[model samples]
Target: MSMQLNRKYITIVFTVAIIAFPIIIGFFMLNKVVDPEEIMITKTEVSPELITIQGGFGDSISKYHGYNISHHDHSLFIQIKGSKFPIRGDKDFNISFTNTYGDIAEIYLVGQDNAKRKIWPQP
Candidate 1:
């Protein structure tokens, strides 16, 4: 009978550990989800005929490949290029495009790892 009681205690502990393991791991993993090379928008300007965006990466410019911008359905997507052989030096971008994102509502800055952050219209 004591052996059965011990088994019950062991089963309970095992089940508790099984349920708690992912919660513990997920808590640790949440901290790592933020990218170290994420981009940050420092300034933005919107005019009647032009829209200007300026930002830079968290790391050195060499760590990145390049940048691109796309306008889609009232939103702007800034895509960061990933590089295997990166260039050396520091650089920031100031790009202007025709104010064509009619009724622009959102702007996204996409990292080299494909992670995205909304930069405009402060959320």
Candidate 2:
């Protein structure tokens, strides 16, 4: 009876150890450092002026108001041209992207300052 009991105890312990091993290793892997070059873009857009914009190009992001002065409705527009579109200090300003890569180029934006931005897309 004693030998059988010992055998059962050893079997149960080994089974538990086998089940727990991967779980423990997975927990440790959570601390592994993530690569900085990899960015998860939530939104995507295509424009001719953004052909050179690739993954990890955008440094930050800002929102711009639309046609209404009071409505404050805006869209996410990361400026790849190194210029601020919103503060052009005009009400009838139309943002234009022309004379570059066709209007079908995919690009990504990166948000650095508490903003949700995207990357230009992987080359």
Candidate 3:
């Protein structure tokens, strides 16, 4: 009889742990993800007719005295020009220019990983 009672307690403990472990892990994961720092917005000026970007929507510089805003990411990357660079966390550098249409430019910075993107400044 005592063995049965002990078995019941063990089963109850196991059940509670099985249900609660994931909840606890999820809570910690959420906490870790919710603490991201704010993204920085920097602005610079570039000629609208300086460069032409050639992939994925075909962007280019179309405005004079336009803006070259970017969120520079220094993550591990290569510019496909025999160059490899590190794009660290919180160090992504994607640029977007301001023209008549909006924050889209013709000049693109193609990465070695086949990520073709406009070289405009971030907002």
Query: Which of the numbered candidates is closest to the native, going by highest lDDT?
Result: 1
Global fold similarity of model 1 (TM-score): 0.54
Checking candidate 2 for backbone clashes, the offending pairs are 107-120, 108-119, 108-120, 109-118, 109-119
Each prediction's TM-score versus the true structure: 0.54, 0.30, 0.30
Which runs of model 2 end up more than 4 angstroms from their true locations? 35-123
Tens digit per residue, CA lDDT, model 1, 26-120: 54433222242465668877666888877665665323334577788888877754322233323465667788666788887765476777777
Provide the overall lDDT of each model, using Cα atoms, as 2-decimal numbers: 0.64, 0.36, 0.34
User: Taking the tens digit of each residue's C-alpha lDDT, what string does model 3 give over 28-68?
Assistant: 43222111111222333445333222211111211111122
- At residue 48, candidate 1 shows an lDDT of 60
Q: After superposition on all CA atoms, what RMSD does each candidate show versus the true structure?
A: 11.5, 16.8, 15.4
lDDT of 1: 0.64
49: Cα error in model 2, Å: 27
Model 2 Cα lDDT, one tens digit per residue, 20-122: 9977774444332222233333334445353222222123332223211111122233432222232322222233333243334333232333232334343
What number of clashing residue pairs does each candidate have, in the order they appear?
Answer: 0, 5, 29
lDDT of 2 at 117: 35
After TM-score superposition, what is the CA distance of residue 100 in candidate 2 from its true location, in Å? 38
